[model samples]
Target: MSHSVEVYAPQNWTVEQWNFVVWSEGAPSNTFGRSYATADWLLTQTAVRPLVGIVCGSGLGGLADLLKDQVAFNYRDIPNFPQSTVHGHAGRLVFGTLKGRPCVCMQGRFHLYEGYPIQKITLPMRIFKLMGVETVILTNAAGGLNQDYKVGDIMIIKDHLNMPGFAGNNPLAGPNDERFGVRFPCMSDAYDRELQQLAVDVGTELGYRDFLREGVYCVLGGPSFETIAECRMLHKLGADAVGMSTVHEVIVARHCGMRVFALSLITNQAVMDYDSEEKANHEEVLQTGKQRAEQLERLVSTMVTRIEYNNNYS
Candidate 1:
């Protein structure tokens, strides 16, 4: 690191803010200013004022395809946005209506293993907040840790175990920006209970009971899959599923006072037995997602329509 480079931080910036700007590749420390810039640019590109924001997970880019009258921007074209380098992520920010409600969906999302700073990983949530998104729906591909969970099951995230946060890499680690939320945000009720129930009701109506289940998801910083021992430990610790993303985004969205609902598509059962020949791989994750893509899309699209009528979020 060079000691001679003195970067300019906006007036009244805190030390934590300065550190994030100097370290975060995208300089996402300016929660209000930088996010507002992206939001303003997006507004200029499309007239849609999204009330709900959706994040598409691995092998789930099809979620964006459901948007009607779509307008989209590549991550590179979006100011201060980090590009998605991983395969399976289309890396676009799509805006349109879902069931007649204006919405924006991330065709792909960022992850810790992508090498972005923690702040950069959660920058899109702030951008979504600035874009008039009141409710957020996030989806991801996860390895089921629960022995009873099947590969094609869809787990409604009722809670999460943030392995990264436990290691001091939380997205909210930087200076507290009142413009975003309180210095110490309450996360005990992070996943909105009402939204969870709404999803349950919708899933039942759609006859998805066999595959729809609710459980705790655990997020790990990963490009590599979890070890057998690690999988066993996480399951014992109460995480029904494990994944590499979604937790950070959910934290940021909730920090900014957005109603959050998350879903995990169990793409593969975690390799919990050392003697078992099953090797956890990315190809299998996408393949399973391909098989269940239509059902996942239907579940979300139906829930989106009813979200407006749900008095809790409205």
Candidate 2:
């Protein structure tokens, strides 16, 4: 007689339970192979070997449009890629040149709240590294937690508070893959200082200082906007801006020894006062992105050119 075994499905499970299942499976053995395959396919599609990989934040998909000689692939068409479900995210991978430097830009990004395993969410970073990307630039729209920040301000990410990681919910939570990185990775230098300085210099040169600020970012597992108390607590803890993405991608990129640069557009002020009537909404986020998209694009493209110059001739 044969015995029937019931498999526990993680589909309807809690986040904690789902994370346990993902951890148990470990990092997929085919990660590198799959990334290599994808990279090879992309190379065949375009002659550009990207040195820079960009992950655009909410409503910032337009950044990829600035690329010269662009070739784009939708997430669904790319092998082993996760689809983007959020509005304002276009779900495409674009390859081209930025200021004559080869680059790849993700028009959209996946999130933990979208029911994707953390590893899957960060798989693109590994693929980017395998595609010969040496540097990663991440941009996101965030809520301004610092009282001094105004909507539409660009906040350079000097540091970040990974609130999810504090609770053992991290992109690096699964079994370590030697091919990608060491078991224990250092995050202290995740965001490159030289790139941060370059961004500041570029913004200054563009006369964007009035709306450009630098501060600490906080990442939270989000599909819901923060409560006033939560906003107050994060602000008290020194978080100047708060968002749902970036930190995970940064962690993965750093693990693979890629240089990282990230910035947040403060789309709205966090509601810290219980009596305040203002509410946070995605429309506002997209609108703010539209308002600053041109300037932000100019800043990033200029930074890309400077990074290329520094690497080649400095």
Candidate 3:
């Protein structure tokens, strides 16, 4: 999951090199530039400056509605923004207050499976960093890969195995913009440990002691679910939850020195040991995601409040 830093010579340019610039046609001088421009427009429209950014996963758009003094911006209205075309996802940006902290929420997100490039998929995270968001809470709907994982459980992502990154596809692959981050960024602990413990403590206080689990998330690029062999391989590689998104954004966030906390809503089992003719589908994923939305909302809201208070007064 590491990128090699090689100096590019124009005469030695490969087709891949040409495609890299083509893929990132008008990405600002840096991600922060693009983000700040968008945030300026958003601030003008809403009069709120977001300190934290939350990206909503499948069937979880309702979390954005809970924000007070909310201002909405459709993805179509943003320049160079790709629209999310998946079911169970609402493509909008919401600015408002949650737990007395000004926050921004992406009610929907773009995925690599949606025919977007890596840089395009991670555009929102860059914007969040530019807009002064120091921390990010990313949520997703994923299939449980661990044998003990059950339906409707909430698993906190501790680390991730990025298959896309391993395959030479990375959001930070193109150019080394020292203005945004270092050429080689270390990712020893992608998810913030303190924020994770806060989530665990919050869940416990809310009587979710037994249901909250923490483990590694394996990220792959997919619109289609995994095959049995793929599930087995992922399990062998130490993943508790497997999904299509999050890892790319986490990398972008970390590159910009933003703390990240991620959670996965276990929508269905990975179908590794299933014998019934019944299969998993998006409908079930959406249903389970909705079922657990309320608890997720409570946990994230409390965590945000605590983070703001601790950072300001502690």
Best by TM-score: 1
Runs in model 2 with CA error above 4 Å?
Answer: 1-28, 308-314
lDDT by residue (106-199, candidate 1, tens digit) is: 9898999989998888999988877778899999999999999999999999999999899998998977887677888888899999889999
What overall lDDT, based on C-alpha atoms, would model 3 receive against the true structure?
0.82
Model 1 TM-score is: 0.90
Q: Cα deviation of 237 in candidate 2 (Å)?
A: 1.0
Per-residue lDDT tens digits for candidate 2, residues 108-180, read: 9999889998878999998887677888999999999999999999999999999989999898886677767
Judge candidate 3 at residue 96 and give its lDDT: 94
Give me the displacement of residue 31 in model 3, in angstroms: 4.8
lDDT of 2: 0.87
| Residue 229 lDDT (model 1) | 93
Taking the candidates one at a time, how many backbone clashes does each contain? 0, 0, 0
TM-score of each: 0.90, 0.89, 0.88
Q: How would the candidate models be sorted by TM-score, starting from the highest?
A: 1, 2, 3
lDDT of residue 287 for candidate 1: 96
- The global C-alpha lDDT for each of the candidates, from Candidate 1 onward, is 0.87, 0.87, 0.82
